[model samples]
Target: MLENLGNRFQDIFKKVRGHGKLSEENIKEALKEVKMSLLEADVNYKVVKDFIKKIQEKAIGTEVLKGINPGQQFIKIVNDELVELLGGTNSRLTKGVKNPTVIMLAGLQGAGKTTFAAKLAARLRKEGETPYLVAADVYRPAAMKQLEVLAKQINIPAYIDEGNKDPIDISKKAFGQARANNYSYMIIDTAGRLHIDEHLMDELGDIKKAVRPQEILLVVDAMIGQDAVNLAKNFNDKLSIDGIVLTKFDGDTRGGAALSIKSVVGKPIKFVGVGEKIADLELFHPERLASRILGMGDVVSLVEKAQEVVDEKDIKSLEEKIKTQQFDLNDFLKQLQTIKKMGPLGSILKMIPGMNSDLGDLAPAEKEMKKTEAIIQSMTLQERKKPDILKASRKIRIAKGSGTDVSDINKLLKQFSQMKNMMKMLSSGKMPNLGGGMPMGIGRGKNKFF
Candidate 1:
């Protein structure tokens, strides 16, 4: 998502790698580039200034690592600062001491509050909590219906008072309902306006006063850049937001909101909305996000996502298949679907160490993967299990069935053969050191067949 910023910083690091030692002048020059990159990424100017200042101070008189180059040292300093700019550590949801923890969602209109509420409900459900979704946004027409639809999708119970326009009254009644029903958590989706207005503030403030919520989370659109920071500050000044939720981070955002909101609003980003899907919400982790922004990759998050989707039994079966070279087209297609469930290919690849850089531009990779998936899906079960049976005529027929050309089919088959060969080598303990030939690894290596 921060591809532009990542690429710009990568170029800066390449320049610093040529220098033998960090001189004051050279360091300043490098920081200048870094500053430009942040500014271009729409990061807050003051945030950028303070961040660069921290890196410069740390870079000066810093003892270089034994085997690390000056560039790597500079990268380390910047990475640490980036982590600080985003929250330094994970901020978790606060639980209410008593039954039914009340979490009030507040934000401007179109900030995805309702959707995030549903996502939170689903997340809590996954964690074995009985969450009751309260549709308290009585002012907005269809707001209650939206919450109901999402609740139904997630199989969570929703409490709504459609006729009641008073949010505070609805919330009070919903609290009573939660108590009677023994719900562990109560999520109140408050109304939002097109812009911050006195009336909206008054309504939210009254609801907060009446409910005394354990968490007042401000849902913000990450693509709004610095406006998100100002909006968060205003909300925190009034209702005192306990945490922030940055939404739509899966888009091509410059990441300004994520970097600036916490420092400006004095609240941690408790969660982030990565996609529109109900399952796309992720807990905010500063270190992992820092690694992502610097192109260092987040292996921990990668493994966690894999564990979530890949069952232990499935992994055992897949391991057996890999060991026996029985990973045929049917198994391959299944693996592709499993990977698709984890998220976008580019995002998944970014979690692998050094794979982000090795992929270069991922648009082509994503496109090619989609094409391969389409072709595989179009094949018959027999064809999938025994791809060797597909002769030239069959290849043409499959291409037509997949709405692709014969050459496209040939390209996929070739790539599949190469991938199978690589898998065999990897399983047979015959894989070569990729660095011996490929400067960046994989795509240009001696075994760059894939």
Candidate 2:
């Protein structure tokens, strides 16, 4: 998500590390590059200034300059400061003492308030809360319908008062209904204007007054750069927003909003919309983001994603199959599906410690995996279990079914055979000959093999 800015930071660190001993001048030069990169990423100028000042104070000190590994020390200082600048810790949703915690979302039009409301509702539901969605965006004709559809998709209850145009009244009634229904949370999606206006603020303020929401979150389009920070400030000034939610965070954004919102608005980024899927909403973590930006990877988040999709029983079964050399095409296909469930291949690889900057175009690799999956799916169950039984006639038939050539089938079988042999060797405590590189299309190539 912050690929551009992250690449820049990695390059700057590489230069700093090239120096055997970092002089003050060398450190200053690196910091200057860092400052320019932050500004170019559309981070707020004042935020960048304060951030650089903090780094300089720590970086030029005797502890860093006299350290055995000055370059590593400097990088650590920058990472620490970056984490603090980005809120230092994750901000969780606030729960009220009473039943049905109310969360009101506010933002300008096209900030993704409606979608984020549904995403948040789904997340809360996954956490065992009976979340009720309330669509109060009366001015927007489609907002109510959209919320209804999303609520149905997530199997959550939604209150859409199409007959009533008063959002404040709609919210009050929804709150009463949610409480009566014994809902754990009620998330109200308030209306928004194309630009900030007194009327819009007044409507949102009235809804907050009527609902007495436990949290008032400002959803912002992260692609809007510094304007997002300013918008959050304006909303906080008028309505006193509790936290910020940066939507479209997966877009080709320079990452200005996420880096600047906390510093400018004095509110933590409670959540970020990574993708359009109902489950794409994620709790913002400052330390994880800092690590990602510095090319250190986010192993904790990657593990969490894995744990969510991979069942314990499935892992045990797979391990047993590999041990017995029975990890056939069926198991291979299932593994592919599991990886796909974790998210995009490129994003998953980026979670590895050193894979961030080295990964070029991953589309070819992703396409190859899909092709392999299709080929495997076209085979019969017996063929998957006993791939050696596929004669010329069967290969021809399978090729036609999968829309691939016979040679493609041969390559897959060859790769699968090598993979099995390698697994056997590993299980026997012997190192397989990796001189031929990884099997399948996993080796380096012009097409950027999977």
Candidate 3:
């Protein structure tokens, strides 16, 4: 998820930050490194060119050359340009002035179109809109069933006509059903092909003609890299997409597509699919993304994910436990699970300030966490609540249950105990400088607690 690019940019920034002053040669070298990074990420060549050009123009001026903090100033300019390239600001979901705004989903097959449809419906539901899902993908019966399954899981109504093969007819009927039922939104999940073809295009065109949808969103795979840009362009050429929804962003994508699509097709990326779960779709925020690309992290997004999964009551209870030193292995396990519910470990780690820069790559960290979680899950409730109850025999049993050696469990328990001690110290006001020392346990550079 732009980890590679973020690392490269961070390294370059470090060199500039180390210098007491900025020179034209150093600035040129830094820009050159940035250009190469963007190109290596597969960002659209034109976009890269324009971006570097803008940064150069702003960076070489007197304001930057004579700035109090020249290195920070240069980074700021690049950040601003990155934000502009990503989309100047957040583009929100469009709701129709009239009832039941129709949002048509368009994309190639296996782009997670059906799943994204369900996610969108669920998101709108949270916003007080009664969204009715229309399974208009009549080409494949499985696609319709998938939508139905997702709809049922989310407790949303899915309008399906399995007997009908024509999507236009199904869509028209679905709209009528929505109107009759007083649904506030109609999300039509249309059919897609493995690749762009005239038959699929014509069918989608017909559906559009019949429904006159207010928003036509193209669901693209971020892992496709530059091809995503091409797909968005083709779709926008034919259907004029109002926005894009990038799926699988949490995958090990270079993030070229997300950066290139909007600039190439002139469409705002409305949402991003960060995980496989139905609750993973997030409304895209360009500024947060800009911060991530520059290795500044996205604390706002991290907090939002935490809020979504951790109820206020749970938070208060956890706080009380931390203050009283009652936070045990059970509470620790619950916190781990809560973080996992937010998303993958790597994605979550990048949201913490300075973590993304220091963790060379988080794939290894994620794998280690999974192993630790497995060991924790193998323990009994009593053992989890009170770690001291685990002696040699219990450790061996837990190790056998978790498919790990005793040492692995020992290390995890030790780390958990240390973390609990730290939390207790902080809560009891015994560690006033804990935040300054650790910085959320991510950043590098002589930060002992981190």
Best by lDDT: 2
Better model by TM-score, 1 or 2?
2
Decoy 2 TM-score against native: 0.96
Compute each candidate's TM-score over C-alphas: 0.91, 0.96, 0.88
List model 2 lDDT by residue over 19-56, tens digit each. Answer: 65556777887899999999998999999999999888
Write one digit per residue (lDDT tens) for candidate 3, span 1-450.
898898898888866664555566678889899999999999999999999888877766435445457668777888899999999999987788877899999999899999999999999999889999999888765888899999999999999778888899899989999889889999999988999999988989989999999999999999999999999999999998899999999898988998998889999999999888888899899999999988888999999989889999999998888878888777877877897788877677778777775555556556666677788899989898899989999999989988899998877777676677778677767864445334324335432221
Model 3, runs deviating above 4 Å: 18-23, 63-68, 357-386, 389-413, 432-450
TM-score leaderboard ranking:
2, 1, 3
Better of 1 and 3 by TM-score: 1
Per-residue lDDT of candidate 1, residues 128-192 (tens digit): 89999999988777999999999999899999778888889999999998989989999999999
RMSD of each: 3.2, 1.7, 3.6
Cα lDDT over the full model 1: 0.85
* Backbone clashes, each candidate: 0, 0, 0
